[model samples]
Target: MEDIHALIQKLDWDTSEAEQAEAIHKLQDIQDEELRLLLQPLGKEYWDGAAEVIVKLGYPSVKPILPGLLEWIQDMNWPGAGRIAPLLREIGDPLIPYIQDVFRNHSQDEEWMYWIFEMIIDYWDKDQIVQIQEELIRLTEGKIIALKALRTLWVHQIYSGESVLLLLEDKMQRSLTEIAQLEIAYPGIDCEALGRGFSEAIFTPELSRAYIEEHREEFNFCHRKSTLHDFVSEIEELVSECMGSGNAPA
Candidate 1:
């Protein structure tokens, strides 16, 4: 055990890459019992170096310690926490059940859920990630985690955009654009109300040229008409692309 600890200590970020590789190779060579025993220290503390070796060792090697690793990273701000994703990604489909467990049990932890989306979920395939799409959509109903879940869906292209908008738009009156504008808007009658009204008018149901033209007087931009026209055209084009690829409701 002392020898395992010494080897793990040698895996530190401060160590030379060559030396870290050497330590990893040595750890890999250890007998199965010793290797399994070494993993027991994981998530018990911030042993940053140990993560890389586990990623290299892969799969069943870390199965016993998987739950602890998940819990340990709930802090999200831990140094070298980024390395944990590669290990989890390497574990691949085997990590799905545990991820579902986290979503099921820890859905209330917005930051933890956000961390899972930002750092971990993107590395997975759409099929693997879709298992949690329902949960992700459910989280969007909450004020705090909505943006994070929406982003995970949008950025990953996890669902057809129309499907996502349909699933969420009625349940959530504010479009992502409207929500973002309101969230960042200064708290005042002029600034807040204009942002709210403008975003809702432009984004609700569909963002189209006809809609923008019909509500043109409501657009209070200081820019020239051409600029506003161009902006509206761009948004219209983007929505068209999303709807084109989406799986529409039957």
Candidate 2:
């Protein structure tokens, strides 16, 4: 193990590709904490090798290393952080709290953070939805990330109407003009089509109401069977139920 650690320490990224590969292969066999401690300083350049070694060491062995790995991710400049998605996926639910912290605290790093959220969404417990929604709302704010998060929540139907109503109200007031302009700027496509696309993309049902309200004349004559008020009523009902449940709306 000491010899293996020495070899890992001596490995140069500038070295020939063959030498790096050979070092990684040998490093995989060293399961001692002393060896891991020695190799920990290699940073992201060694992530591929480290991940391989950690995974091969099995979950029990790798469990001890997660906290350190998670701490490394908090460093914006950490090279090994980029490999976190795969590592967390490899580690599975045991890493959920760590990933959630990243999502909550790293609002500016939405691109990377979203992948972490995406990974954990599948395993989210129902009770966790309120917190997840709050995090999503806080992180996304006015950005496209909010839209994506909403879509994810919508697909899962995780939020009650009350939570959704808050989001709907926010979107109605904030994004109405932006969406209307999108319709006006692109005259060939009707508002319903745009609403459908928005609904599909953001998973917000209120977008449909906003679309109809903005273009009432265009859609009213074409679809006489259903009124915009009906949709609004449905949304309100959902919102009431969500609020009554006392869950924080996402």
State the displacement of the C-alpha of residue 36, model 1, in Å, after optimal TM-score superposition.
7.7
Per-residue accuracy of model 1 over 1-250 as CA lDDT, tens digit each = 3387677767666778898778878887655556544442445342565666666677787677676666646765675566776676667677777878887788878677667766678666777767778877777666545645655676567655665556444434343454446435522334345455567766565655555575454443322333434434444444454566553311
How many backbone clashes can be found in candidate 2? 7
What TM-score should be assigned to candidate 2? Answer: 0.49
Q: What are the RMSD figures for all models against the true structure?
A: 12.7, 12.7
lDDT of 2 by residue, 89-180 (tens): 56666775665676667667765565555554545655565556667656545444565565446545664444556786775455445545
lDDT of 2 at 3: 78
- What are the lDDT scores of the predictions, listed in order? 0.61, 0.56
Instruction: Specify the highest-TM-score model's number.
Output: 1
